[model samples]
Target: MDDMIAGGCQCGAIRYSLAGPLPPAYACHCGECKKQSASAFSMSIPLDYDQLQVEGTPISFTTTAFSGRAKHNFFCANCGTRLWHSGSIPPDSITLKVGSLDDSSGIAPQGHLWVSKKQAGIKLDQAIEQFDTQPDDVTEWRGNLGQNS
Candidate 1:
């Protein structure tokens, strides 16, 4: 709760921390996200991949995305709770599910992505930004950390 974002899986088998303010959070209404989360949409915070630090190894599941790119979902191997996802975009970023956060009080979706696939009944509030697709470039939004392997 000290401004740094931290969270883990349901059983505490995996943990992660974000060193700084999270990039804008967004609601992804893409079909791939919905099926992966088993929900109407997936709430996520985009972070430079190097900014993510995890305490445990997560089980990985790979799937071809709607864009035909390969994506890997990482989850707590013990609790079966999805933790984060990587691939298709900059390998330097990972979309962490907001539900996995330890404290999500200040976190809110700034916009809706892949809105075309959104459910008919799931209307987004007017104040939030909406994009038909993901942002074109996030190079300027890189975190203040050195590259990580």
Candidate 2:
């Protein structure tokens, strides 16, 4: 069993716990991600729906994803702090927002996506895997994360 980790929204209105060894996170540099994070990139940790336990109701909305599929965004209604998002990749998916973690000091994305849309003057880690666009090789992506996919 892995250690359990806790996280919450900015206003502490919505909290969540994920049964650990949290999966490796990836940095998304897509235009939408940049717009949402208001930064160079957004970090995300993918998890199976059952792995996360959340308290309090989170408001959500649907948006068109880079893949042209519906992506559901969940955020705290009170603080407007985005908690997580759901992509159609696995009907019941939850991609946790690393920024929401109470202690995210250790988060370092293992890979990068949508570098084609990355902002100017942004330099990525040469050690980790990177893709100009969405990577088609799932196994390679997992392997880059040190997971045996």
Candidate 3:
């Protein structure tokens, strides 16, 4: 990905620009993620909260994840397209949906999380590490990606 990337919702609303090194993408297979994404999993790239700039207002809903931590899900009010998620789950960073990127060309998930809640029939890459649940520390779970400073 570029040092700076741009993306938005399905419609024209809720545009965002991310500047700085983009983290490798990761997948979450928890039930809430599957339900919100309507897919086997939700793919996201974590960015420093200060590195992202969002334009236009997004309707947000707060809910607790399988981890029991609260999160605020942001979506386009017009088309209701899910965008990014923010909250206590990751603390200082916002989880930007990879699919929302204007160009997702070379982006791919580096690992999988919440595999314990993964739905049946879902298959994951055996090459990448899969966590039954969140690791004790993000650093241990994401390797160097968690070393962001």
Candidate 4:
């Protein structure tokens, strides 16, 4: 069994607990990510959807991703803090914005994605792998996984 990670929105109105090790975290430099975060990039941890449980309802806004997939951005309706994002990947897995976590010190991004959209003056360490676009290998693997079966 994996340890549980507890977190919530800034206002504590939306609480969530994620069990098991989070999937490899990624720093996304896509335009939409930057726009939403108002930063150079957005860090996220992808976890099985069923493994995530929220205490309150989160507002969702659907938008087209760079891949042309319909991505839903979920946030605490009260505070409007972006909490998680869901897309066409697997219903069992959704990406949680790292910023939403109460304790983010344990989470470190393993790599950077959508490097092509990265902003200037944002220097990334050489230790992590950088991809110009979404990693095809991860997509294939996620697509093949059965949803909470």
Candidate 5:
């Protein structure tokens, strides 16, 4: 794919490239995101499974999320750096962590999800759309972003 974007894990154990022009991103403030990222929130760009091309063997951990969906997190086996995650909530789509990008300047989060669960002292952008919980439809969420922003 032309204009492909590429990135790797901290230790360069896991590398991946995605086709150009990924979907808009969002920040998740849910507890799972916080714990998984070791931060106040996690940001990711949703991409079709077919758009991702990976070059390393990553270990995976599957856990039931608060939404009752099974979330699969993949990480570099050598350095334990998280690569990406997929969940039943988004079926057939993979959420690529913005943090893993070689150049994250191209990625911009357009909204925030699970804001109700956002931790104390964690600030959010009031300018972007905010959802108290995960929206049932990602398209609806994106639509709201377009309409509101």
Candidate 6:
């Protein structure tokens, strides 16, 4: 965590630098995430909004979350690489897409969300903290992942 983590869009239009200490990432199996990732699940690392410094303008679209709050998705205009997501409910944080990282070799999801929608072919560690849907208690959820985070 001493060195800075950097990444950018495929076309190199939108670049970002993420500061440490990095928070634990999570694998989301929600339908929206699957569509966004075009895969079985989407990986996200939540950090303070300012922790991720952006260098270029990114086009964004708004979508409503299950919480009924507006969630904004930002992507590169050139390569259509989805960068991150921000929600109105939590104005101070951003969910950085793990795929956008230049070197994600060291990152791994500490928890899973929307497990009910998880792909049939995917297998998860039984010991990992997971939920069929969003956990009701943020504290409990965080506590469960604290060891790994």
RMSD of each: 5.7, 2.9, 3.4, 4.8, 3.0, 2.3
lDDT of candidate model 6 versus the reference: 0.83
Model 6: per-residue Cα lDDT at residue 24: 77
Least well predicted 10-residue stretch by lDDT in candidate 4: 140-149
- Clashing pairs for model 5 are none
Angstrom error of the Cα, residue 110, model 5: value is 0.7
Clash totals for all candidate models: 1, 0, 0, 1, 0, 0
Please provide TM-scores, in order, for all candidate models, with all chains considered together. 0.79, 0.88, 0.84, 0.84, 0.85, 0.90
**Number of the candidate with higher lDDT, 2 or 3:** 2
Deviation of model 6 at 3, angstroms: 1.4
lDDT of each: 0.75, 0.81, 0.80, 0.78, 0.79, 0.83
Q: How far is 97's C-alpha from truth in model 3 (Å)? A: 0.7
Candidate 2's residue-wise lDDT over 105-124, tens digit each? 88788888898998999988
Per-residue lDDT of model 3, residues 79-125, tens digit only: 98998888743336678898888888887788888999998998887
Cα lDDT, model 3, residue 32: 79
Top candidate, metric TM-score = 6
In angstroms, what RMSD does candidate 1 have relative to the true structure?
5.7
Question: What lDDT does candidate 2 reach at residue 128?
Answer: 78
**Candidate 4, lDDT over the whole model:** 0.78
Q: What is the lDDT of candidate 3?
A: 0.80
